[model samples]
Target: MQNALKELILQMADDALVLGHRNSEWTGIGPMLEEDLAFSSMAQDKIGHALALYTILHEHMGEPDPDKLGFMRKEEEYRCCQFVELPIGEYDFTLARHFLYDHAELIRYEMLVNCPFEPLAQMARKVRGELKYHVLHADTFLRELARGTEESKARMQAAIRYAWPYALGMFEITDADAQLAAAGAYAGEKERRSRWLSTVSSIINDAGLQVPEPDEAKAIYGGRKGYHSEYLKPLLDEMTEVVRLDPTAEW
Candidate 1:
């Protein structure tokens, strides 16, 4: 059970860390000033969440310290979903990915709020609260862009279609899923995916956008098992550069 929980925690932490880095890349290059700040703030929240989760693993589960766990992992050792590792392409594409991703996150954390694991449950409650604003920000921008103009709608729809497969990969099941679910440690990805589809479909339909049919979408998987796109290697190199340069140095 401890091993299963550790795997879950590591995956969640990796997801947050990788996506936070991707979002932070937009700090100075967002479509506008407000958006730049918004993404940056959310990035900070995500990285903070990752740190907290890693701390739990260190203090309770005998894992490496947060810094080493976060910054020194091999590329194949990472368990982040491929969706978060993908580069933030364009404004519309990034917005679409953010909308899909955060809804899943919000639902996942909500499920974790009642988990049997006390430490994780407490952390979930706090993280879930922070995710509310992330959902709000993504929903607001998605709605406006989807309903704004013919071109905006077209671009958003295209972006959604392009990102849909990767978004589905966010729910890739793991061998430990059954054990975790049975133990009430988590509600499992299958349930979360169902709720996520319902929520995102409603938001998309209400905003006059189309939700890609699940039957027609192919999920891109394997990231949770350490397989990743070409992009992840470069991203990891950049992420760990400072730490790797001086492992003995302290902040």
Candidate 2:
């Protein structure tokens, strides 16, 4: 039970760390100044969340320090979903991905709020509050973009189609998932995915967009098992560059 709980926490931490890095890449590159600030703020929130989770692991669960676990791992050691490893392609794709991913994250944390694990449940309560604003930001942008001119709408729709499969990958089930669920440490990916679909569908419908059919959506998996896309290796290399240069040096 403890091992399963640790696995769940590590996956969540990895997801936040990677996606936060991706989002931070937009710091000065967002299409609009407001979006730039918003994404940057969210990026900070995500990385902070990752650090908090890692601290829990280190302080209570006997895991290594957060820096070592986050920066010293080999690419294959990461358990983040393929959805977060991909580069932020464009504003439209980034927006769509953010919208889909955060909704799923929100639901996951909401379930975690009542977890049997006391530390995790406490963390979940805080995380769920932060995610409310994230979903609000994503929803506001999605609605505005979807209702804009033809070009903006087309771009959003295309991004939605392209990201939907990878977004589904965020919910890839693992053997440990059952253990976690049975232990009441988590609600499991299946329930989260179901709620995600319903929530995202409603938002998409309100934005005058069509939700991709689940049967037809091919989820890209394997990240939880240590497999990743071609992009992750390079991203990890970049992420660890400074840390690798001087592992003994204090930040």
lDDT of 2 by residue, 1-251 (tens): 88888888989999999999999999888998999999999999999999999999999899999998988988888999999998999999999999999999999999998888889899999999999999999999999999999999999999999998899899999888999878778879999999999999999998999988875248999899899999899998999889788899987
Off-target runs (Cα >4 Å) in candidate 2 are none
Error at 153, model 2, angstroms: 0.5
TM-score for each candidate, following the candidate numbering: 0.98, 0.98
Q: Least lDDT summed over 10 consecutive residues: which range in candidate 1?
A: 209-218
Clashing pairs in 1: none
The superposed Cα distance between candidate 2 and the true structure at residue 51, in angstroms, equals: 0.5
Looking at model 2, the pairs that clash are none
lDDT of 2: 0.92
